[model samples]
Target: MREFLQRTLVWLIVILFIGLAFWAFSGPIEGLIAAGVALLAWLGFHLYHIALLLRWLEQPTAERVPDGFGAWHTVFMTLYRTMRSQMQSKRKLTNVLERFINAGEAMPDGVVVLDENDRIEWINPMAMEHLNLDRKHDVGNQILNLIRQPSFHAYMKNASFSQPLVLQLTQPRELVISVQLVPFDSTRKLLLSRDITSLERVQTVHRDFVANVSHELRTPLTVVGGFLETLSDMEEVDQATLSHFLPMMMEQSRRMQSLVEDLLTLSRLENSPKAVMAEKVNMQDMLDTLMVEAEGLSQGRHHVRLEKGCNQWLWGSAQELHSAFGNLVSNAVRYTPEGGDIVLSWKAEGERLCFSVKDSGIGIPREHIPRLTERFYRVDRGRSRGNGGTGLGLAIVKHVVARHNARLDIRSEPDKGSTFSVIFQRERSAEPEAQPENQA
Candidate 1:
């Protein structure tokens, strides 16, 4: 306002000077001088009036009614600039929203959208797969009612009007879903859901395995200790009976030892970071040693052969790869029929270095195949214990493969046989080590 008043004063003075010069040219010298003085007084009067007008124009239209064209100009330009800024902000927000929509739909997991009223608004491709949602019916429907889960329904009904609600999926399988509600305003809400089923399943399995293994080992250990105490108080027991008891005690101790060692190894793998500084493991050397060890364990009854064609080295911890490959190969030898042929093959498939241990064994059922890697999850518990299987080979294999940033594929059919494969990323050439035949 001060600036506008100053500009007006300057423009008004310039106009007065021009007017006086024009009027002075048509008069006598004394008269022209007098007219010039009159013009300066006229200029001051006009300048004061313009100043008052500009000050009134600059007053906020919301507080004062604009009474003239001059005042209206100020109000109109102020509103236009404010509207322009608001429009630009909305455009930027829309761009961000569009990008979020595209990224959310592209996700591999399920996603659902909800309006402020907790009604379904949108769903992603993955939501269609996991939820079996029919868009035509699901859209515009209340989310809690559509799911039809009592717990979820109650949760949403009593949900905090301003926050999110979480519900577990207790349907086809036990799945954990974290549902988040983003409230833009009291009348707007966005729902985001993430599937944590696999994570929760892993946690449950870990807990159950620990409890089961502890019980299994402790029971046998207690019995063996009791037998040793009885042996010490043998006042009339036969030596044959004592001898028989000793072997059983020794076998039980060995089983306990194997279980403890495998548990420790699994613990290490799990506690450590998933990504380690991967070193190049010579694929040929790795398989050759595994086959040799496996053959020795088989006592030459089951011939283990290695087919090596992968020039690429494996990119991971050599020790981890050895353990992963060794477990798979040795597991095959243990399960395969006597005198059966076990083939260990390695080749490069795309970016992955693939290795497989194929054996003629009692194959696993389709349902059990998914969980065979779980600790102590035996297809035949009696046979497994009788064969001196600690029931941790597959579990160990799983952890080792994960440490190596590799994938384990278990393909088997009933009675035909099973093939366990580990797919590893190819690495740069590694320094040559002892040929892939040494087992130490």
Candidate 2:
């Protein structure tokens, strides 16, 4: 309002000056004629300035503001400054928006922005993968139409986002995705999704492990309790009956002891951050001791042979390797029949050195081969228990091999035979160092 008044005052002063100059120059008639001419000239000048202002307004970005005299000059400068300030602010906002988008793209979890109608406005790459969505083509499409899971549709309609929904997809692989929606602004929604399949598997394994441990312990405890009750109840039992019962009790006690020891070994292997012992282990000597132990376990049932094909000794914890190799030999003796052949071979295949136990035992089915290393996972539970197997031998072997950067391979066919091989990398194999007699 002040600017308007100032402009009005300036125009009035110009008119008054023209009147006074005409009055001072000539008489009333001449003065009036001159005044009319002067007013026309002023009108033409103002008209030209109006045309420039109109052109500037039409293309403010293309044309610069017109330089004007007096109040017109002030008006042009004010509009120009305001427009420039607004442009600068808009540029800053655009830069900030671009940075926000980049950060969202880099996130591990999926992020999706939706409008009031649940139409996908924008989605990151992770969302594209999780939902199998094509951002380029599927944008502006309703999320419900694409991800047509019944649970997700129901959840969307309910508009309750306090909890997340887990969606299981079975197309490419068995994937578990956790999804949640957050309402922001007035009608905008933000959808978040994360792959939680690994977490879910771990939880399942933990539950199964606890249940298996309980089941294993319960059987032994029940047997021990029943026998103790029987012995206490029968005060005058015969010597032969007592001797049979005592051996049975001792066998169950030994089984329990073995189970407990294996569980402890597993616990220690998991808890230890790194291998504790680093020494040159003589593979030939290790196999020699293992053969002796295997023979005792076999009780002249299976023909055991040791074929040392490689002189490359192992460099690692001797105790861990022994426990691993010993388990393989023992398992072979336990599983192989009376006349079956068990061949323990240590040889170099290419750059990898392998210690394998091949047995002509009751072979495993194809379906059960993948889970052989799992704790307490047996192909035949009754047969394993009858053979005095604690079900944790292969699980221990797996951990030991992993610690030494080795791989365990199992090849088997039902009714044929099975071969279990532990392949160690060449870097892990070392030449046996010479002993110095002076120290002795």
Best by lDDT: 2
Question: Candidate 2 — what's its lDDT?
Answer: 0.88
Which regions of candidate 1 fall more than 4 Å away from where they truly are? 1-147, 153-175, 178-199, 229-233, 236-239, 273-292, 304-316, 345-354, 428-440
What tens digits encode model 1's per-residue C-alpha lDDT throughout 1-440?
Answer: 45456655665676566656666775556555655766677566556655645775676333343233333345445555665677788889999999999998899767777777777788887775555577877898877767786766765666574544456765556657766656656665665667767777888887988787987698679979889898888778797997889888988888898888888888888888874655756676676688779879899788678787655665567886687778887788878888787999987787667889999888888989988998888898887776777788898898887776678999999787899998876553344455545553
Task: State the lDDT of candidate 2 residue by residue for 31-117, as single tens digits.
Answer: 677667777776787788889899888889523878887667777788888888888999999999999999999999999999999
Candidate 1 overall lDDT versus native: 0.74
What are the lDDT figures for the candidates, one per model?
0.74, 0.88
Pick the TM-score winner: 2
List candidate 2 stretches off by more than 4 Å: 1-8, 62-72, 435-440
Per-model TM-score versus the true fold: 0.60, 0.91
Clashing residue pairs in candidate 1 are 285-436
* C-alpha RMSD values across all candidates: 9.9, 2.8
Question: RMSD of candidate 2 to the true fold?
Answer: 2.8
